[model samples]
Target: MYKILIVEDQEKIRNELGELLRRYGYEVVIIEEFENVLEDIKKAEAHLILLDINLPVYDGYYICKEIRQTLDTPIIIVTSRDSDMDELMSMNLGADDFVTKPYNTQILLARISVLLKRAYAGYQEVVQFNNFKINFSKGILINDGQEVELTKNEMKILACLTKDKGCIVSREDLVSYLWDSEWFVDDNTLTVNINRLRKKFESIGVENVIQTKRGQGYFIE
Candidate 1:
């Protein structure tokens, strides 16, 4: 799922936007504190940002400029400011799109879809871990001129684990991401797949990449 960070200060509108996005299957993150918004955005690792012009300390345009300095994350200016200058300024500061207040739900979703598709085209199909590179499209792990093929489940599991890098991913979450219906998949199935991934990595002289967090879950460092 794609994660979207909302930098709106109004309580009612923020909550409403979050609910709407969640209903449409997008992960929603709201920014409550504005003092360190830029730092928060950095930690969010969100695929996109929903920004409001009227904020607490720093306005959306300033924040947008700061973000553009370091991040390419798509930003959509959603504010009550409907003037042409407002939209033009947003665009000049590197915002991907602009939308006025009381936006049509369907239109906002469509814009988000288009921006996400355009922004993430050909993104993250291959990731590096340690000295090896894992290719998701080909389902192979390569290192030192040697290649090791991975099974469907193994590839999915590895991809999920590597998505957050050092974060511990719960077993239930992993199961949910791997299978359509978690009810039909058992814990042993995931354990078996993880074991297979470990063996595959070991075959290519990589070890201890996937670590278990006892009762919590697993993580790759």
Candidate 2:
């Protein structure tokens, strides 16, 4: 699922946009805090951002430029500012698209779909989970400034467990998933991989990321 972040200050509009995006099968993150908007954006790890120009502290233009300095995440300026300068400035500051308020719902959705496809086509996905940045394509788990690589089986195991956050994934189910991926692993081998995954996280100062529900299975809480 693609994560979309809404960086609008208005509560009503923010909630409305979140609901609109969620209804279309997109993971929506609504940013309410403007004090540290930049840090908040980074932590959200959104594939696309719906940014507003009129903000509390630093306006959207400044934030957009700063983000372009590092990230290539798709940014769509969804603001009430409908001036020629506003649109031009947004494009100049690395916004992928610009939409004025009172936008047609279908048009907005289409813009989001097209931009997400363009930005993430053949792109490696990275997601943030519990203080860890997981890059499934690269098979790497990063914490703070440290990173550890995972083997094929280990990566699959982590992916399975994290697919449903805070929920116990049965060992049988995990084995089946690995088998489907042609990894042919037994229960004992699964245990070994789980232990190895824990050790790798421990090596990066991340402990107990994967929790076991003894009689059931394993989970990340």
Candidate 3:
């Protein structure tokens, strides 16, 4: 199911929207924290966002800018501010769609479905974890808004782990997978690759990616 993050401050409206989306078979996440809306967005790891412009401290425009800097997660502005200027500003801030309040719930859901289809086409290629988006195709790791360059081997290792998330991946299995790619690398070199990957993740504010199991191989925790 697609995950939808609602950033509206109105309690009644937030719950209403959340329940409505839930009825449509979508996973809904509501942001209770207004101070660090950006942090909330990252943690949600949502496929799309429903934002209200009239927020407490920072408006939705600023929050939209923060999200645009790193993620391409589709955003739809949900506000009572209905004007060309408001819509234009939202577009400039990288909002994908804008819907005013008092709008039809069915219409809102339709718009969300359109944006999700355009952005994720059923599901996204990247895997989300701890605010990190790992794009196996590009061999890149995007954490928060920071981009971390990943080597081919590093991508392979991560791809393996993400494939079997929360499970142990034996070193011997990793070596076998690498060998199939005709990239012959010994255990020491594998360790070097893992360390390099960990450092890159740390550079992007992720201190740990892979964890050791002593006699066992490794697991991403």
Q: List model 3 lDDT by residue over 81-152, tens digit each.
A: 999999999999889999998999999999998986665332235888756898754446898798865544
User: For candidate 1, lDDT tens digit of each residue in 1-221?
Assistant: 67789999999999999999999999899999988989998767677899999999999999999886545578999999999999999999989999998999999999999998775554367888878998765557998888876544566687788877799999999888776466656568788778878988889988888999999999998
- In model 3, the clashing pairs are none
How many residue pairs of model 3 clash at the backbone?
0
After superposing candidate 1 on the true structure, give the runs of residues whose Cα lies further than 4 Å from its correct spot: 124-221
- Residue 162, model 1, lDDT: 81
Distance (Å) between predicted and true CA of 44, model 1? 0.6
Order of the predicted models by lDDT, top scorer first: 1, 2, 3
How high is each candidate's TM-score? 0.60, 0.59, 0.59
lDDT of 2 by residue, 142-200 (tens): 99999876544565677777777898998888877655432434457667678878999
Worst ten-residue run, lDDT, model 2?
Answer: 178-187
Question: What TM-score should be assigned to candidate 2?
Answer: 0.59
Name the Cα RMSD for model 3.
12.7
Candidate 3: 10-residue stretch with minimal lDDT: 177-186
